[model samples]
Target: MKVLIIGLGSIAKKHIAAINKLDQSAEIYALRSNPHSKSDIAGVIDTYNLNDVKVSELDFVLISNPTSEHFSTLQQLVEFDIPLFIEKPLFSKINEETQSLVDEFEKKEITTYVACNLRFLDCIKELKTILKDAKINEVSVYCGSYLPNWRPGVDFRTVYSANKEMGGGVHIDLIHELDYVYWLFGNPDKTNSFFSNTSSLKISAYDYANYLWTYKTFSASIVLNYFRKESKRSIEVVTDKGTYYVDLLKNTIEFNNKCIFASQKRIADTYYNQIEFFVKNILIGREKFNTIKEANTILKLCMKD
Candidate 1:
């Protein structure tokens, strides 16, 4: 199988490594915006421009570029109607132009999957199973880390995450929390959000976001930030019986103070599993994994407009 990955950033490298490990036979080609971008993947092909190669010839395309460039990149390849695995948040911000491109994909019946790898986590999957018959009252999810600690040796301000135009912010960059909230429970009836850039970090975008989503059956609160000294990511699902605490960073699920599931899986396993499922299910007509429609809904919630 031939896979053309757009953008050679850190996330793109993870996809390449995961795909290659999953299927040694798969040929991986990278489309990088920066000519100087480096790839750790051995023996993989690289291209600076999309015109240099035939995008239609590839089996699938993975858009791992900066959020700001996603719309333009999709516009260039939408005509090909190739299956796409787009990164989360859709774009830095949703606008008429990007929405039109998504509409075109839907109208053409193009097969596409949005990347929200958090949904594939073992702990998350196990929580879904445990909550199948259980009742929930409220849920709280949080993901926070020091901006500079994200990528070692690289200035956090220089990366796309620090620039608002590039779709860099806790709201968009940490959209996995939003996606999973929508995944576990449907859209909220009402949304209240507070976003600000009070951090000392020299970023053009907001460094903090706190949102409250009220659903008919239950309520959810999400917290995202780039100022936490110690990295932490966890979820708390409250129910009529008891609150279920899930430590995502440790891959542990506890219900009523008892550990239920403990996953020994690595973080990369989520990417591997997501790509594997997408390839097996999306390639064939079996089922649609993460449709653009659903992604758009989550995107709007992240925007909290």
Candidate 2:
């Protein structure tokens, strides 16, 4: 299989790792906007000049660019009819241009998938099974970590997450919280959110955001931030019977004072599983990973006020 990755950022590297692990014979190509950004992965990744590579030549394309540039990039590639595996949130925010591109995808029946690797986490999968019959009332989600700690050598302020215009913010960057909620409960009926730059971090984007979403049967509260010294990501679902907690960081779950789900596997396994599933199931039309249309719905929910 021939695969082309449009962005060579950290997430793109993970996807490349997953792809290589899945199929050793697959040829991997990457397009880097900055020549200086090139790393010494020549044998593993064949770097291509964006203008020289035709979209039709690849089996599929992975769009892992910064959030603000996603829609414009898609507009350029949507006509190719190749499968697209896009990174999450779909866009920084929805606008006419984005909606128009979505409409084009719909019209084209594009084979598209959006990345929401959190849904493939062992704890999250177990939590879904536990909540299948529980009477849910409220769901609370949170994810926080120091921005500078994300990429060891990169300056936090220089990344897209540190700039609002580039779609750098706690809420959008940690949107896995919003995505899992949508995956578990579907779209919310209404939503309101508060954003703040409460941290001492010298970034233009909000350091913290809290979102409240009301559903037909329950409500949810989600919080994300980039200032926490210790990293944490978890979800708590309250029910008439009890509360179930899924610690994504620990890959464990507890319900009614009982240890229900626990895993010792590396969290990176989720990325592998997600990519494998997308390739084996989604490509053959056996199952659907998160689709672009569904991602747009989640995108609207993320932007709700």
Candidate 3:
């Protein structure tokens, strides 16, 4: 298969690696803005101009560019009628223009899938199954990690995650919790949020974000931050039966202090599985794997004040 990737950043590299693992013979092409930027990964052809890409000959296009450029990039490629695999947090901000673009995709029946690989995590999948028919009461989600330690040997201030203009805030950056919350429980009747730069992290983006979503029978709270000495990502859910704790960083699930499920899987496994699923979905002509509309709904919730 011939795949075109628009950006050669870290996330793009993960996708490339995942795709390669699934199909050893897949031809990979990258469209980068910086002509000087090159890929160290073997078999990746780098093209500086979009005109050099033959959309008709490609199996699909993956948008792994900065969040700020996703809208324009999608606009440029949407008319080509090629399937799209966009990285998470579909847009930095949603507006009429963005909505119109979404409408255009729907009108054209474009096959699109927005990446939210966390949904494919082994522990998360098990949690979904356990809560499939349980009576949920309340949920608490916390995700915190130090920004300076995110990428070793790289300046934290230089990345897009540190700039608000590039969509680097904790609210949008750690949107996986919100996506899975919606996936497991559907939309909330109301949402309240607070996003601000509460940390000394030398970045222009908000380093902290908190959200409360209210449903008919339950409520969920999500807290995200970029300045914590020790990294943590976990979820605690209260149900009629008991409370459940999920440690994403540890890949384990527990109920009332008793371990229920544990997986020795690395986080990279989710990325690989996600790409594998997307490839199979495309091959079988399935278009319902995390559609743009579904991602947009989560994006809208993130923007709520």
Which candidate wins on lDDT? 3
Q: Per-residue CA lDDT of candidate 3, range 1-305, in tens?
A: 99999978899999998999999999999997987987788999999888888889998999998999999999998889888999988999999999999989988988999999999999999999999999999999999999899999999998888999878888899889899898888899999999889578867998999999999998999999999979999999999999999999899999999999999996778999999889887545574877888788889998888
Alpha carbon deviation, residue 268, candidate 3 (Å): 1.5
| Residue 35, candidate 1: alpha-carbon lDDT | 90
lDDT of 2 by residue, 1-305 (tens): 88888887778888888998899888887877776666555535656575677667787899998888897789888878889999976898888888888888978888899998988988888888878888998899988889999889888899888999888788788788899898888788889999889679978998899999999899899999999999988888899998888888889988876878899965788889988888988887646567888888888877765
The whole-model lDDT of each prediction reads 0.86, 0.85, 0.90
* Model 2, global lDDT: 0.85
Best by TM-score: 3
Measured over all alpha carbons after superposition, the RMSD of each candidate to the real structure, in angstroms, is 1.6, 1.7, 1.1
- Estimate, for each residue in 6-31, the C-alpha lDDT of model 1 and write its tens digit: 87777887888788877898888888
For each candidate, what TM-score against the reference? 0.95, 0.94, 0.97
Ranking by TM-score: 3, 1, 2
Candidate 1 overall lDDT versus native: 0.86
**What's the residue-level lDDT of 174 in candidate 1?**
90
In terms of lDDT, which candidate is stronger, 2 or 3?
3
Looking at model 2, residue 134 earns an lDDT score of: 82
